[model samples]
Target: MTIYCDESGGLNAGAMTFAAVMLSPQVAADIHARFRSVTGLRGELKGSRISLVERAYLLELFDRAGGRAWVAMARRDTIGGKPGGAVPSDLSVYAALLNLAVGRWLPETGGVCTDVVIDDGRYDPVILGKVREEIQAGLGAWGRASLAESHRSDGVQIADVIANSLFNIAAGSPRAHRIQRIIEPMLASKAIRVAELKDFG
Candidate 1:
């Protein structure tokens, strides 16, 4: 199974959106449990700020899981109601980042693309479809893919919580940091634009 999680509408001029994709049910549970154990997050994950420590915990979990787990990002084009000075608008760059991250988790050969789940929200299928197509095309079209609309399952929900926190952390980290600096050119380039969840809706 292959899963996807993401955040949309945040990081620029709107509310932060978070999501994740899972490739295995058992692995998903293990990931969620580990997150809860490490972060002490209780109850529903809606509208919660996953702490920095919890974010770190998940990165470690993904690292140890050694499976296909990745984060796709769309930097906000504007901040504080002002035009984003210079973020690029290349979706492929972000898509490449997402693919590279997921590719590491998927097997190099004979990998079945069984699951490609995402949070069910107002986003358009095109956005998700574009990402999946890029992954498959860049990888292979034989990979099976599906979306988990309105994910009510416990495992998927938890994955969503974990994914959201991690993406926010990576995108919102201090500008002086390494990862932040690495992506700064991408973020400051003109490839980004103000996108709305309803655009996908």
Candidate 2:
């Protein structure tokens, strides 16, 4: 299986979300092809750019295609205990959330190997490398781990949608209801795992 990862929001936002979608290679490719054909979307498929109707269609497609996702969320208001308490850096927040989400959704089992692909953003190479090392260490004796860019990955696009949806829900956006409805099936099936962190220090 392959895990495609993407993030929504940032340190300045009300909340941050990291989402990962898991799918077999064949399924991922098939989903990408179907999405393009159905929506006629050119270039990369980003949630922020799509219409509500399109989002619904994509979510339904994911359900029918057996796609699974995991989401990690951190609310800025609840990050620190006090007004001036120590807070974790963005990279730290990401790494911790990622670790928790992966552990829950794709625990290190001596079975099929799982590869991870993350959206190409502004992450520092050193920090990203360290995160990769940590993940591999945690998965020792189960399977090897590697991280790659999602520039040309369709799976990552799917992850982006999940991240954005989770972010909206966490922020209590008006569109949350619609997004939740679209993803309710995944939640009901436990195909979409969520980790909400209150402390990052």
What are the Cα lDDT values of the candidates?
0.47, 0.77
RMSD of 2: 2.0
Q: Give the per-residue Cα lDDT of candidate 1 at 123.
A: 45
Q: Model 1, 92-180: lDDT tens per residue?
A: 33444345445544563465544555454544678967666655564556455444554444445655544454444445644225333
Off by over 4 Å in 1: 9-11, 14-22, 46-48, 76-113, 124-144, 149-201
Model 2 lDDT per residue over 124-179, tens place = 77777777788777766655556556557778888888888888888777788888
Q: Best-fitting candidate, measured by TM-score?
A: 2
Best by lDDT: 2
TM-score of 2: 0.89
Quote the lDDT for 124 in model 2. 77
